[model samples]
Target chain A: MGDAGKMNTTHRRLILLLLALLCALTSGCRRDQDAGKVRIKFWTFPLWTGITGNEKDGTTEDWPRLKIKEFEKTHPNIKIDLEVVTWQGGMQKLDLSALSGTYPDICYLATANLPKYASQGILEPIDADMTPEEVADIYPNVLDCCKYQGKTYVWPWLCNALVLAINVDLFKERHIEYLIPKPPERGWTYDQFTEACKALTFDRGDGHGKVYGYALYGIPLSVEYQMLTLVLGFGGQVYNKEGTQFTLNSPESIRGFQFLMDLLDKYKVVPPGPAGMQGGQVGQMFANQEVAIESSTSGVLKQLKMSAAKGDFPYFNAAIVQPPHLPGYKPASMLSVGGYAIFKQTDARKRRAAIEFARFLTNEENCRALTVIGQFPARKSVGNIYPGDVDMGVVSRLIPISRVYFTAGAAELNPVINNIYQSIFTHAMTPAEALADAEKKANKILAQDALEKGLDAKGGKQ
Target chain B: MTGQDSTLKRIIKSRWAYFFVAPAMIHFLVFSVYPILSTVYLSFVRFNLQGNTWVGAQNYQVALSDSIFWKSLANTALYTMVVVPVGVGIALFLSSLIFPLKPSRQNFFKGAFYLPQVVSAVVISMIWLWMFDSAHGLLNYLLSTLHLAPISWLGESRTALPSLMFMAVAGGGGSAIILYLAAMGGIPDSLYEAAQIDGANRWIEFWKITLPLLKPTTLYLVVMGTIGSFQVFTSIYMMTRGGPNFATNTIVYRIYQTAFEFLKLGRASAMALILALIIIGISAIQFKWLGTEVEY
Candidate 1:
C-alpha cells in the first residue's frame, strides 16, 4: 500500500510539470477555461479613431459604451478587454506579444499589412470561422488585399477613396472659378488646369510666388494615389485588364508619367525642382490665402471643418470633389484603408468570437459610429447612416462608381512604384526610361514568384 | 585506499569553480553568441508571403543583387568616413585645449561637454532637426546676419547628409572628450620636459611625443566613431526619412525597412550580417595598424 501511494504522488508531480509547459506554450490561454466565461482581447489603432467629441475621457467612454452595449445584446457572458495602440508603434508592441505567444485575439491594422503577418502564421484565417455569404459582405477588392492564397485574414473595415479638396476662396480670388468642382461635370480638363495654374502663379519679381497649385508629399501612398488619378485619367492601369500580367510599360502609362512631369516643368502647378511638400503645407497656404487648387484626401476636409467650427482657419472654406480628369478620360481616385485582422494563433472558439465581434463592429449602425471617431465605413449602408453636417448625399455619389486598384501582387508593385518615383524625381532616370526599367524589374519579380509556385507549369492562375 | 579517496575529494573541490564561471559564460552564450550565430544562419534563407523557408544562399544572392543595399552600404561608408575622423579630431583638439586649463575650470568644462553623452541620440537629433529647419530655423536666422541667403539644410538632398555630419562633429563633445582627457592625464610630464630641453617648439613637442602617445586613444575613438556612424538610423529617420529621395538611406535603415516594415527577415539578416563583417574588418584594421605599443 505504501509503495503504491509513493508512485501515485510521483505521477501527480510529473503531470503538474507537463501542465506548466502546456500553459507556457499557450501563453495567453486562461487557466479557468471551465470557469463560466469567455474572454477576448481587441486592439485598435489610435489614428483609426479621429479626435471625436470634446471629452477628456472619450476613449474610455466610447470603447466601453460600444463593447458593453454590443456584448450585453449578443453574448452577455463573454468578456472583452479593449486596448488602444498608436499606428506609429503599434506593430512593435504586437510583435513582442506574438513572440511571447500572448498576442491579442483581434487587432485592427492596415489591410495592406495582412500579407506580412499572415505569412508569419500569426494571423488566423477568417474563412475558417465565417461562411462564404458572410465573407461576401465586406467591400469588394478589399477582401482580396486581406487574403493570402484562399485564406481570409481580416474584415475590411473602411473605404477611404481619395477625394480632391480645392480651396474655393483662393480660386475665386485668382478668378479661377471653374477650377473648384462645384458642379459634377464642370471640372477642369488637364490642359485647362495647366493653363489655370500658370495664370494663378504670379512670380512676385523680388523673390517670386512661393505658392504652388499642387504640393505633393514625398511618400509612396501620396505619390501612388495621386499618380493613379493621373494614370487612370490617361487610360492606364498598373496591370493588364485581368491583372495577371504587368502592363505599366504601355504607351498609355507613359502619357500619364509625362503629364506629371509637364505639371512641374511646362505648367508650373507643382513645386519646382525635386522637392516634395505635402498637403499640410498646402493647407497652411490655403489658410494663409496662398494657393488656389490642390489635390488631397477628403479626411482633411473633416479636420478643416473642425478648425472652421472653432473659427481657427476662418478663411479655409474648402470644398471636396472627385479628382479632375485629363481633357478626355474617366475620372479616377485611389483608396487607402486601415485594416482589421484576426490572427491564425487564435483558437476555434476565439476565432468565432472575433468574427462575431467583427460583424458587430461593421454593422451599419456601429460602422457609422466608428466613422464619428474618424474612419470612413466601407459599406454604403453605413454611409447612409453617417451623422454629420456634411452632405452624405454627395458622399454616396462615389460609392457605386468608386473602385480599388488591385492586383494579386500588390506587395511587389508598390515598392517598384516608389523606386520609379525616387529615381525619376531625383533625375537619376527619365520618365520613359524609369517606366521601362520598372516594368522589366517588376516582371522578373513576378516571374520568379510564379516559377517558385510552379504556376505556369500547372496551368494555374497566379 | 586513503590516497584514492583524497584524489576524488580534490576533483569535487573544483566543482565550486564551475559555479563561479557558469553564470557569466551562460549569459554570454545566450545573449551574444546565440544572436550572432542565428543571424548568420537566417541570412541564407528566403522568406516569401507564405513564410520563411530554407533557400540556400538565395537571400545573400538577392541582397548582393539589390542596388538599394549597395547604395546604403556606400552611404554608410561615406558617413563613417566623414564622421569618424572629424568627430575624433575635434574631440582630440578639445581634450588638448581643456587639459591645460586650471583644475576647477577644466572639471566644469569636462562635465558640460560630457552632459550630451548621457542624453539619448534621438533627443539630440530632434533638437538638431528643429534647428536645421529650412523655414523657421536658428541656423538660417544666424546666416541671415551675414547678408547671405538662408540654406535649406535638410530639405535639400545635397545638403542633408552634410548637415548630419556637422551635427555628429558638434555633438561628439562628451564621452570622446573625456576619453582623450583621461589618456592625456596618464601621459608622463617627464617626456614633455625632455622634449622641452631639446629646444623643440610647442607644435613639435605635440607632434613628436603627444601625438604618438595619443594613438591608442585615437584608435579607440576611430573604431567607436565608425561603428556608431555606420548604424546611422535614428538621425536619418528622425529627420530626412531616408530622403528627399533615397540619398540618405543607410545600411541600418535599409535593414529596418526590410525586416520590420517589409517583413523580409531573411534578407534583412543578410544585410545586417554583411554590415557586421564590414564593421569588424574596419576595427581590426585600425587596431592592427595604429594601436599604440606599451611599456611596462
Candidate 2:
C-alpha cells in the first residue's frame, strides 16, 4: 500500500509535466496563428496532362506555372508552397496529411471522394462563400454533387464529361455511312450503332491484318461512360427514386452490365478482348489507328482536336459524336469532377492566404483558359471553348434526356457502383455476380458509417 | 596506501568517466528509448489524429481477427523464409567464388556486388514497380520480344508477392555480401593452404573449412534478415497496396493502413502489438536454428 501510494504520486507528477509540455507545444503552434506572413501550402495532382506536360520548361501543360504566377500576384505575402502528388497515391497522401492536422492550405481531390472527407470534418464548408447566385451560375448537375446536408464543402471545377471520338476516315474507307443523330432533333437506337460498327469492321484475313467491328476499348470500366450512357438510353435506373436505397441489383443496372458484356463476348463486334485494354491505352490505340470508335473523356478532346488542327493525324476525318444510345433508352452518362479544397489550418493567416490563393486560381479567367484543355467552366459567364472552330458532330444529344448520379455529399454510392462495374468487366463476373457482391459490400460500408457516426450518417434519402 | 589522500581522487576519477558517457546516454534515452516506450504505450490505447486513450486489449483483439493481418503475416513469413537463407547462401557462394581470385579482381567484384546495397530501398522499389507494371512495363516489353503472353508482374495478385521478393533479394545483395567477404578474409589463408596441402580439392576446402568459419556471420545475417523482412512495409505501399486482393499485404503495411486509413486506432495498435510479438517469436526461432556450438 505504501509503495502504491508512492507510485501514484510519481505518476501524477509525470502526467502533470507531460500536460504542461503538450500545452506549450500546441499553444506555440496555434498561437502563432495570430501573427506572421500567411504561408498557404497547396497540394495537387497534375490535371490530365499526357506524360509530356512538364511545367518546368513548358514542354507540355504550363498550368502550374501559369496558375502559380497569378496566385502569387493576388496574394503577395502568402507563401504558396505547391506540392505535386501523383494520382495513384493521392487519396492516402491527403488522408495521412489531414490526420496530422497539419495539411496544406489547399488540396485537390476527386468530387467522388469529397463527401467522406467532408463528413469527417476534414474539409471546411464553403457554404459561407456561395451565395444563391453563385450556385445558379455553376453547373446545377455538378454543384448538386458538392453539397452535403444543406451545406457544401467543395466547389466543383475542371469537369470531365465523357464523349465518343470516331475514326471517320476508317468509316469512309469502309464505305460505311456514319450518322450522329443529334439528340432531341434525332435519337439513336442500339441496332443503328451495331450496324454502323459492323459495316466499318473488316477482317483482312488470317495473319495479314484484322479490323474488328468498332474499336470499343473494354478492359473494364474503360467503358463506364458507354455503359451508363447506354443504360440511361435504355431508360434504366441505377438507384431508386430515393438515393438512400441502392438498387444496383435491380434489373436496369444488371441489364446495363449485360449489354456492355455482350458487346465484347457475344457480338464479337468490339475489339478482341475489350476486357484487355484500359481507357488511355484504348485512346492511344484509336490515335494509332488500331481502333475506329473511342469512348473517352472530354479531357482528351482538346488533344485530339489539337492533333486534328495540326493536320491529317488519326486521319483528318476524325471527329467526335455525342454519347451513344440504346433503343427506347433515355440519356445518362457518368459525371465526374476533379478540384481542390482549402483545409482548415491551425494557422489562421495561413488558412486565409491559402483560401485566397485557391480563389485566385479557380477564378472565372482561369476557368475560361482551362476550357481550351476541355475543362468545363465552374463559373457562370465563361462559355465553352472546344479547342477548334468546328463542332464534334452531335455531342451528348441526350444531355437533357440523361440523368445525373451524384450524391455529392454522399460519396459512398458512386464508388460502390464503380467498384461493381470494374469487377464485372475485369474479373468477368456476371452482372448478377457483380451486383450481388457490390450490394452487400455497399450496404456494409453504409452500415459501418451509420454505426460509427450515427444512423443519420448516411442522409442520402433522408 | 595514503588513504586519507586517496578518497577524493578515486571519486573524481569515476566521475570523469560518467561525464564522458552522459551526453550519449542522454541522447539514447531521449531519442531511442523514449519513442519506443511511447509506441508501446500507444499500442495499449486508442490512438487517433488529435489524441489517444488507453483501451487495453481491444486493439489486440481486433488485430487477432483481421484478415489483412494474417495476409501480411503470411507475406512476411514467406519473405523471411526466402530472404534469410538465400541472402546468406548467396553471400556465402559469392564469397567462395571471389576468395581464390587475384586481389584486384576480388575487390572489383566485391564492390560490384555490394553496389546495389548502397542504393536506397525506396528508389530500388520504384524501379522494381516499373519493371513489374502489367502493361507497357519493361518486363512486358521483354516478354513481347519472346512471343510470350504478357505476365502482369505487379498488377496480378499471384505475381505481386514474388516480384517484391525478387527485388528484396536483389537490393539485399549489399550488406550480406560484404559481411561474408570480411569473414572470408579473416579465415587465415593458412587454413585453406593447409587443407589443400592435405590433398583436399577446392570444393572440399570450402565445405569443410570456409563454410564452418562463416557460421557466426551466417547466424548474424539470418537473425537480422528475419527481423528486417518481418517488418516489410514500404514496398507494398509503393507497389501493390496489398491488392488484387491482399497478396502483398505485409504486417507493417496492414498496421499502418489500419491505424491511419481505417482510423481504428485501437485495432491498429492491437495489430502492431501482434506484429511485434511475431517478430520476436521469429527471432527466437532464428536464434535456435542458427546458434553455433562455439567454445566461447
Candidate 3:
C-alpha cells in the first residue's frame, strides 16, 4: 500500500475508537461511580428553612444539608443525593423527570398534586411501610389529601393554612381596636368585617396616598386559595363532594364573589385594580401598613415572628384571624399541605433506604423545625408547637375548619377560576355572570379529565 | 456520474471541511430536529408520561374546539401586530439618529441601548413589574405628580396587554438597533451623495435611498420580531402571568400552561404545531410582500 493509504486506514481506526470511547463515557457513569454503596436520589424544595417565608433565602440549602449529613451518619452504607429545586419551576421539573423515567426516588410532593401523580402510577404507596401508630397520629384530614383511591401515596410532613393577617397598628389608628378578633375569639360576621374595613380605609394626608383596608391577591392564573377561603366561609365549594363537577355557579358561591366585589367597588376598601394584585404585592401593602387586613397564610405569621426576633422592624405587630362567614355558616380557612412521596422503584434496597430517609426527615425531632417556620405538623402528637404565641395558636385552632382547595385536575382549573375574579374585579362580568361562565369553562376541563380517565362527562364510570 | 455519486465524491474531496462542520450539524440534528420530530409525533398521540396511545387528530380537534386556545391566538396576533412594526420603526429611527454622530458617541449609545439585551429577561421583567406597581410604581408616581389618577398598569384588563406591548416596544428595540446600525454602516454613502447632487433634501434622500437600501434589514427585523412577539412567555410568566382575565395570555404561554401545568403533553404538542404553522404562514406572507433584491 502507498504511504497515504496507510495513513487513511490509521485515521479511520482512530475515529472509530474515539466514537466508542465517547459512548462508554456518557452511558451509565453514575452506576460505575457508586459501585458498593446504594445511592438514593432525593429531590426536595427548601422546606425547613428554620423560619417562615425563608424559602427564598440563599442559605436554604443549609438545613437540608445538615439533615442529609445526619441521615448518612446513621446509614453508612446508603448515600442520599439531595437536589434542591425552586418553587417556581420545581413541579414542572418533576413532571419532566417522571416523563423521562429519571425521577428521584424520594421527593416533596404538594398535597394538591398527589392525586394526579398517584393516578399516573408514578408514586409508590407508603401505606405498607408506615406503622399503624404513625398512621393514627397524623391528622385525618391532612392524611386524606395524601391518599388516592384508598392507598396512602405521600408521607404528610408539614401544612400551611390560609388565614387573615391584620396590621394591629392600622386597626388602632382607625380606633377599631374593639373590632379586632382576640386570639381565643377568632370569629366575626361578614357585615362586621365590612364595617371595620370601611372605618379603616381613608386618605391620610401623609403623601403615601390612600391606605386601603383589605386586599386578597386577585390576579388570574395564581392559585386563588386566598379567594377560595372566602367562598368556603360563605358555605360555598369550588367542587362538589366527589370533586366530579363544577359548582361555582351555585347561589352561595355568587354571593361570596359579590361580597369581594362590594369590598372593591361599593365599600372602596380594597385597593383599585385588584386583578393585578398578587400575594407579594398584597403582603407588601400589609407590611407597609397601607392596608389594615389581608388574606395570608401561617407562613406570614412565621415571617412576622422572624422579623420581630431579628429586630428587622421597630414594631412588627400582627395577628392571625379567620375569614368572616355568613350569618349561619362557620369561619373557614383554605389550607395547602406539602409532604414527601417516594417514586416507583425496582431496587428493593434503594427503595427501603429512601423510605427510611423519608421517615427520618419528618420525625418529631426534625418536625420541631416546623414551629420556627410557623407551620403545623402532620402528626397530632406534635401538639401545640406554639404554646403561648397568640398568632400561631389561632392558626393551630383553625386547622379543623381548614378546607383543601384542590382536587384532581385542579391545575387545569386555575386559569378558569382566575378568570372569574378578573372579570368580576374589572366589571366586565357581574358576579352571577362571571360565576356561570367559570362554571362552564371549569366543566369543560373536568370533561377532558373525565375523558382521559375513561369516564363519562359527569365524571362517572363509563 | 449520478447526482448522489457526485455529491459523495465532492464530500470525500472536501473531507476536512465536512469534518469541521460535522459537530454543528450533529448538534442541530440532535437538539433541534429530534425534538421537533418528537413533538410532531407526540401531537398525534395520547401521551400521559406513563405511556403513549396513538390517537390521530384527536388532540388537534380538542385544540380547535377550545375557546381559550382561540383567545390566546388572537392575543398573540395582537401582540405581534403592534410590537413588530413599532419595534422595527424604533430601531430604524434610533439607528438613523446614532449613525451621524461621532464614533465614540455612537458606541456609547449603542452600548447603552444594548445593555438590556445582555441582561436576563427574567430580571428585566421583575424590574418592569415594580415599575408598573399601582401604588408605588414609578409610572403611577409620575402620573400623581401631574395630578392625574394613577393607572393600574397590569391590574385592569384594558391596560394589561397594552402595558406588555409598551414594555416590549421600549426594551426590545436594543438588539434590532445594533442590527440596523451594522446594516446602515454597510450602505455606501455614495448613494446619499448622488441623491443630494440631484437636489434631494435630507428627508427626500432618506425616503428614496436609505429606506429602499434598508429593506432587507427591515424585513429581517419584522419577521424576527413577529416570531419573538408570538413566543412572548418570560415577561408574561414573570410579570402578569396572563392575568386580569387572561387579557395578556399569548400562544406560547398557553402552550406552557397546557404542557407543564396541565400535564397534557399531547395537547400541548398539537397547539405547538398549530403555532408553528401560523408562524410559517405569516412569515411567508411577509417575505412575499416585503422581500426585494437590493443592489449595492
lDDT (CA) per prediction = 0.68, 0.63, 0.84
TM-score, candidate 3, is 0.90
Q: Name the candidate that leads on DockQ.
A: 3
- Model 1 per-residue lDDT at A92: 79
The DockQ for candidate 1, computed on C-alphas, is 0.19
lDDT of predicted model 1: 0.68
Q: Which is the leading candidate under lDDT? A: 3
- Candidate 3 chain A worst ten-residue window by lDDT: A453-462
Question: Distance from true position, residue A13, model 3, in Å?
Answer: 32
Model 3 Cα displacement at A183 (Å)? 3.3
The alpha-carbon deviation from the true structure for residue A206 of candidate 3, after best TM-score superposition, in angstroms, is: 1.7
A-chain TM-score of every model: 0.78, 0.75, 0.86
Among all windows of ten consecutive residues in candidate 2 chain A, which has the lowest summed lDDT? Answer: A392-401
DockQ of each: 0.19, 0.05, 0.31
Ranking by lDDT: 3, 1, 2
Tens digits of lDDT, candidate 3, A101-133: 899999988787876677667889889899999
> Best to worst by TM-score, what's the order?
3, 1, 2
Q: Per-residue lDDT for A59 in model 3?
A: 68
Query: What digit string (tens of lDDT, one per residue) describes model 1 on residues A132-163?
Result: 76566656655655566667777776766556
